[model samples]
Target chain A: MLPEPAVAAGKATRGWIDPRVRLAAALVYSGATAVWQKPESIAAALGFALGLAVFFRLAPGPVLRRLFAVNGLLALLWLILPFSLPGETLLQLGPLAASREGLLLALRITLKSNALLLALLALVAPLPFPSAGHALHRLGVPGKFVQLLLLTWRYLALLEQEFGRLRRAAALRGFRPRTDLHTYRTFAWLLGMLLVRAVDRAERVRRAMLCRGFQGVFFSLQEFRLNGRSLGFAAAVAAAVAACAVLEFGG
Target chain B: MHISEGVLSGPVLLAGAALAAAGTGVGLKKLAPDQIARTAMLAGAFFVASLVHVPLGPTSVHLLLNGLVGLLLGWPAFPAILVGLILQAVFFQFGGLTALGVNTLIMALPAVIGYGLFSRFLKGPRAGALAAAFGCGFLAVLLGGVVAGLALTFSGEHFLNVALALILAHLPVMILEGGMTALCVGFLRRVQPGLLPGRPSVEVR
Candidate 1:
């Protein structure tokens, strides 16, 4: 089964906001935050993202785990950028100098990355995957693309299960993956078999849908209404995002 | 490789988005209504296939399989990979909203290039077929690394070293994927010849 997002189990701000609004807000916020060069503005964006997380009542554990994973890549940047970027040397280590500009760049990246991630988690994570697809469709994304998105989302768990079964079958046959030609060959064949089965299954699925009168269109039962509360939420988010832009570009 | 959010500059991000959008548009245009389900299912399979981790010395690395995907699906690989990246972002938070276009282009463009470079050899003799498969796999990853490196370097001149490091880091995975893709193609050729690109479709009941 696909894991749920790390939203706390209760009424949260996301429940009151429309998914389209939330998605747009997240996109705007992240896009604006991505270009901000000042550390002060980026840090303020982070603070606003944190406030959104709290308002959304996101569970801290899973959110922090995702943040940690993101930072692992940043940590690599921290190691290389400080030494490679040419600027005023803050520290010298055996002929290698850590430049102040590089350090500041790394700091800005870390802040900006965390801020964008937190906003995405707070705004977009609350909606179900299919709901998000439908929201995209309503937001003027191509219908066929949205259909593909929804269908892929529906079958991800099934395909993962199928792969799990294949792995178990291989294991039962005393197959152990190692750093060797035989192991690689075995894995390649396993994946090959999986692809073969997937092709067959896709044929069967297409036929089944055709038998059921499946056209190119997908009909969803979920309807998004723009109520007063959702509008208010949108207004609040727009205001916050506007404030961020001002802070980023002003003065 | 998924480049996390907030790493790329504005122009780089915009250019990536524009290119990805064009690719996806052409891909969607080529896809008929009746083919949507088949494309979606194959995409799901690829998504699952990507999660498989193979041991390398003491650690493991997941498969990219973009070469194989492109070979199988042709131009549809663009939309397929775009959806896959979207699902990854929504489910695992591997990439974020803004970087989606850049990430899609990084993985899918290489897929399309692999198809262009290697699809003809699938019908050739056994040795040539396998060699082409390996080339597809190796070149796809190599080009992906190069594109990613370019994206980073274009973001800032200071990122040149980091970009080079990123390309260097993909070398081992490139070798592994090359071998695996060759064997996978061999297996498909022997078991289900119709599955490979440019082959006559065989009806399987």
Candidate 2:
């Protein structure tokens, strides 16, 4: 079977702060990191993100997992950027040389990515996706988009389980994935079969909804109310963002 | 080819977001309430695509079946990919939140194009569904790679080099996906023809 769903973090996150606040902070922090160009600012953002991670009680395992997932590209950037950039050489590897500009660019990317990712892990990781969707809806994201996000999240695990069974059946039939036509053809059928099954499931879900007197909107029983702690969290995000801005401008 | 955050310049990011927003608007508008659940299911498929993988000689690569999704869902691929990327970003941390608009466009736009090009081919009497399926997958990967490469060029990376690298890296994937898409099409053609596009009566089951 597939790994557990990512939003599983949300289950432990209730009674913290309003998800909307966390979601807003995440957007702002990420946006701020994106605008950041200075190494100092980016470094500060990274530190802030790490601090938030610790504060949010995110375990090192999950954080490291997220880091490793994105590091391949970052590593590639490190390799190419140093040699590709034209500036005073910071270091040289055999015939290849790293320019000051390229090193900065590469470092900037690593810092920004880590900082933003950590921020997201801390802020959004704990928030159940449904609440996040409702938060988005309250924040004026299109109802359709919010609905779409929730639906996708709702079904990802189910579909994965279905596909897992298919894969198991294939493996039992002596299917080992390789660079061969048979493998490709088999995988194709597997995916196609998956779509067919999912389509059928979708119809059942629709009928079930209809039978329950379902309407176009998915109503939630949870109420969203922002309070002092949420306002405090917002202030904290603003300060961190302001710090990033300062680092960008002051440096 | 999910572009991470903080890579592109502000203008480029804005432009990509705008284009993606427009595309998603069209896709979302076309989605009916009855179809919302189906779209969600397809979105689930897209989300799992990267998780499901097979060996590719020296290394393994997961599937990026945006073309198949596009071919089936039409305009809905836009919103579907958008939501999928959002989940991947938050949960998986593959694409960044800031670069989400750009990432969505890179993957979904090609799906839209694939639908336009391959849908007719699948239904035509003369064209083999297999060829159409292969074309849809191969070309979709090619287009997604090229556009993503072009997007990187806005950040001052060389166009040809980036595009070439992206495409070349996925060359095996393209061929593999092409074969897979063809097989999927063949299977659907036989068993659940109603689920595919260009069918007048949508499958009840």
Instruction: Tell me the DockQ of each model, to 2 decimals.
Output: 0.75, 0.66
Instruction: Please give the TM-score that candidate 2 achieves against the real structure.
Output: 0.93
How do the residues B1-205 of candidate 1 rate in per-residue lDDT, one tens digit apiece?
8788888998899899999999999999989988887889889988988887889888999989888888888889999999999888877887888888898899899999999999988867888889999998998889999888889889998777777888898899998888888999999988988888785333321
Candidate 2 structure lDDT: 0.81
Candidate 2 structure quality by residue, lDDT tens digits, A1-251? 33333433333443558877888889888876887788998999999998887777776776686688777768988888888878999897899888999888888888888898888777876676687899888877888778778877888889998888998999999998888878877887888788888889999998998999978876656688899988987898799889778878984
The local lDDT score (0 to 100) that residue A80 gets in candidate 2 is 82
Across A134-228, the per-residue lDDT of candidate 1 in tens digits comes to: 88888888999999998888888888888889889989999988989989988898888888888788788889988989887777677999889
Candidate 1 retains true contacts at a fraction of 0.88
Displacement of the residue A135 alpha carbon in candidate 1, Å:
0.6
What is the CAPRI rating of model 1's predicted complex? medium
Tell me, by TM-score, which candidate is best: 1
- Rate residue A196 of model 1 by lDDT: 84
